[model samples]
Target: MKNLLYILVLGLFIYSCSSTKNRDFNKKEITANANDTVRIANDSLEYEIIVIEPGFNLFINSIAKPRGYHSQSYLENKNIFLVQEYNSRVNQPFNYNPNLYIQAINYDNFVDYGYEVNYMLYNYFVFFSREYNQRFSVPTRI
Candidate 1:
């Protein structure tokens, strides 16, 4: 009787562990989907900006200003300043979190990357700053 009880308990423990592992795998898939990637590109200008972060899609849809709210020039100006500040941080990884400031953004003021590209880039910087609790020298108000 004692031996039978031990065997049953051991089997239940193994089953529970397997179930937990499966649940964790499912959770990871959901999390991956949530961490969306947004790409903004202008073929004629040959410029592209890719933003990969969690909750950014939600932020842009719900929190950010409408697409045509700001003029193209305004978006470009904000993007230039924000990109400069962000790239500075990326260069000095010791001063900033390396994981957060992953790569330098190549944004040229002379290039006309269109209204959509500029708007998305500007909003991305805003999202990144707010999400990571970072502050730029220039204003990041939406």
Candidate 2:
């Protein structure tokens, strides 16, 4: 009876450790997903929106725990010229106000990452004007 009890206890300890390790691994995977776009498990339940612009794809993925759903928005482009900083937390803390986060993306870097820039003629002119207003202003040297 003593030997049998010792074997049972050892088996339970091994099983418990294995289960705990699996749980820890799962948590790590979920935490890592925050960095990029993913088709979340139960993704249909998560809220997500993606916006595309000339330079990048803006992606916002948030989960409303109480509602058991997530929300996301994608705002592309470097049009947003403002910056703000905040503490980081789990489960999409940015949902409190996604616009600020959307504005943080560096669209130039997105282009550097091989994203194509498709500029209509008018858009090209407008972008150029903003980028080179001083040059455009100089008197032409005939």
Candidate 3:
């Protein structure tokens, strides 16, 4: 029982030490408004972002692009998705790769957008995937 207690304590200590968020987050007052944007820092990068504290339902109503913004062919094509594969063959257990792919978008295309437009678009797609499992591809085959 004593040995088990020591192991449990040691495991807890290790887990606490490994938590990056606990070490980096500052114990400071977070000031922001629901109708406004706020600045947040992680590591050393400071990002001026909006906090939409609602789920995807609200996100779809507020931030998502209209259905006709992208064509049906562009939405369904699989060739444009970039597959991110970085698993070690020898050290890690082998797993089947998903039919994942990504498209390289030109930033110049969105030149008229406001500052952080690219950042917002990036986040939008991320949430779109989590909420709807929707994927996108480049117009041209890579």
Query: 1-142 in candidate 3: lDDT tens per residue?
Result: 9999999999999988888655533333232233333233343333333434335335545676665565433433321232121112112333422332222233333123332333344444556456656444433552
lDDT of all the models against the reference? 0.84, 0.31, 0.42
Worst lDDT run of 10 residues, candidate 2, spans 80-89
lDDT of 2 by residue, 46-141 (tens): 322233332211112222122212111111122211111211211244553443223332233232221112122113223333434412222222
lDDT of 1 at 82: 89
How does candidate 1 score on lDDT?
0.84
List the lowest-lDDT window of 10 residues for candidate 3.
82-91
As a whole number from 0 to 100, the lDDT of residue 36 in candidate 3 is 37
RMSD list, candidates in order: 4.1, 18.3, 16.4
TM-score of 1: 0.77
Model 2: lDDT equals 0.31
Candidate 2 local lDDT, residue 67: 22
List, residue by residue over 1-142, the lDDT tens digit for candidate 1: 9999999999999988888654567778777766777777767767787777778888889999998999998898888888989999999999999999888888888877889888888888888888888888986564
Candidate that scores best on lDDT: 1
Q: Candidate 2, TM-score vs. the true structure?
A: 0.20
Query: Against the correct fold, how does model 3 do in TM-score?
Result: 0.24
